[model samples]
Target: MGIIDINKVTYEYIRRDEDGNVEGITTAVNGVSLNVKAGEFIAILGHNGSGKSTLAKHINALLVPEEGSVIVDGMDTADEDKTLSIRQTAGMVFQNPDNQIIGQIVEEDVGFGPENMGVPTKEIWERVEESLRTVGMYEYRKKSPNKLSGGQKQRVSIASVIAMHPKCIVFDEPTAMLDPKGRREVIRAARALNDVENITIILITHYMEEAIYADRIFVMEEGSVVMQGTPETVFSQVDMLKSYRLDVPEVTELAWELKKAGVPIKFPILTREELKEELIRLGKR
Candidate 1:
């Protein structure tokens, strides 16, 4: 089994009326199954209400499956005894940095997780320092988070999660509210965590550019996984993705259009360099 295993997991909630009457049931996660090996960087993409967030919540035991099971590091998320360990093993970084960060100082906020876990005071400080450094926020450790930019505050939120030393981290639309530069900083921090710290990362984002950096991508629609493969394989099906309300990278879409125009360009050009290389190979430079 991989570090994270989701087996036919299904979750649903009952919609209630203002009068507290019973309403219809909405299934948010419908029998989704996938796995993430240790130290791998996985990306999940989908339109809103496609069950991406619900599926992510299962990894940390925030939502128990109504029909199937979710196992993280061999611990069933349904097991109450293992809930704390499972959450510690898979920390979560939510979308809004303002909501996630509550520390008076950056370092104090980062240390909260370890302190809550009953780690030694000295070790908590050590973890706080290391986590902040890992996210490139150590220089601002003593500063108030309220004074930092959106990206800086988000990095501090990530640092707080990592201080718990989770084996994996699940990011739920972390860059949705940031500017382009802030988005880049968060992605860079995530990549470094995977490469340097060897932590498993499951990133759920709407940005195609962010998904391209993942080792693998899973596309969802209506609470089901409709596509799963390497980035190149997944992005090549431009029409299929569009049918599911997604767009490929700009370069990839341009290459696809050129291919349709009989330009001999590749269909899925993920990066600018790839498009340039293909055009040169075809003697169109």
Candidate 2:
């Protein structure tokens, strides 16, 4: 089986009134099923309230499925005994780095996960060093997290997760709180982890540009996956994605407009480079 197997998982929560009375139930994840092979980069895309975040919670067992099962590395998330193992196997990096970083020093923050897991003192330091270096934060290891920028702190948060040596990392909109440059920094670190370390990455983001780098993209709408395919294939359906209140990469939308205007441009132009080459070819013809 793949490193993550989510089979027809369904999750819902009861909405309670201020008086502690049950109002109604809202189904956040509806019969969603997908698999993530080890060492692959998968992106989950959806606008807010589309259930993307809810689906992500299952990968590491933060939220158990009420109807189906989420099996991570062959262990079912529903099993209470396997919860810790599942968490160790799949680490999580949330949207806000401040919320995740809790140590006085950078290295201390990075080392917290392994230390809490009862790793030897020597190995915790080892992991801290390796993790900081991996994210290009080694030099800043002695500094406090409060002094770092949004991007640097996010990288530190990532370092904290990697120090645990998890097989997969779930980034739930890890770039949502950063500026453009900060967002770039976090994405670069994520790509490096997937390329260099071969760590499986499951990224949940609404940024269309970010999704282009994924091996496969899953588009969610109203608590279910509506589209799943290579980035090119999924982004090619401009109209469909629009209906889901989602946007494609900027270049893709531009190319779509050009195509509509009879420019004969190809569908799903992911990058400016591709669009330039397409225009150059058209000029030559």
Candidate 3:
């Protein structure tokens, strides 16, 4: 079985009035189901309020499905006894690093997870060191989080999650609050975790460029997965994605435009390198 199995899950939010009376109900997730194999890098994309974040919460048990179930590493999220185990199996990193970082020093922040888990003090420090190194934040271990840049702080947040030693990490728009460079830094750390550590990565992002390296992509619209495929397959349909209020990566859009202008380049180009190589091949022809 896959590391995560979401079976026809549906979740709703109750809107209450000032008097605490029910106003209406809105479905955040609607009968969505998918699977993620161990060690796979998955990307979930959507506009705001598209239910992508809600779906991510279910994976980490931050929100339970009202009409379906979520299984993480064989533990049911709905089972109170298994909640802790499930959380340990799938750690989460949120968009804002300031909210997640609590310790005065970086290393202390990273060690909090394992320390809270009751790991021996020695092992906790060891885990803190390794996790920081994994995310390229080792040298900053002694620095205060407030002294770091947005990118650095985000990396520290990721290190904190890594120190927990979870088999999988769910990134819920982790780069949304950062600048372009910061976005790249966080995305690089995430890719390294999946490539070098072989950890399962579920990345929820609005950035099309970040989704290019994913093994698979799921695009959500109005609380449902409207499209899913490899980057090439999914981005090739630029028109379809636009209809869903999504845009393809910059290079992909350029390639699509070139193709429409009667160029012989590939229909769905992912990177600048791919576009250059295709142009060179066409020149030789």
Q: Work out the TM-score per prediction.
A: 0.97, 0.98, 0.98
Query: Candidate 2: deviation at residue 47, Å?
Result: 1.5
- Candidates ranked by TM-score, best first? 3, 2, 1
Worst 10 residues of 1 by lDDT: 260-269
lDDT (Cα, 0-100) at 64 in candidate 1: 93
Clashes of each: 0, 0, 0
Residue 193 in candidate 1, Cα distance off native in Å:
0.7
Q: After superposition, how far is residue 115 of candidate 3 from its true place, in Å?
A: 0.5
Judge candidate 2 at residue 283 and give its lDDT. Answer: 93
Report the C-alpha displacement of residue 74, candidate 2, in angstroms: 0.3
lDDT of 1: 0.94
lDDT of 1 by residue, 1-285 (tens): 899999998999888899999799888999999999999999999999999999999999989999889999999999999999999999999999999998899999998899989999999999999999999999999999999999889999999999999999999999999999999999999999999999999999999999988999999999999999999999999999999999999999999888898886766889989888898899955
lDDT tens per residue, model 3, 140-226? 999999999999999999999999899999999999999999999999999999999999999999999999999999999999999
**Colliding residue pairs in candidate 1:** none
TM-score of 2: 0.98
Candidate 2 Cα deviation (angstroms), residue 166: 0.7
- Badly placed stretches (over 4 Å) of model 2 are 18-20
Q: After best superposition, candidate 3 residue 20: deviation in angstroms? A: 3.5
Question: Which ranges in model 3 have alpha carbons more than 4 Å from their true place?
Answer: none
- lDDT of candidate 3? 0.94
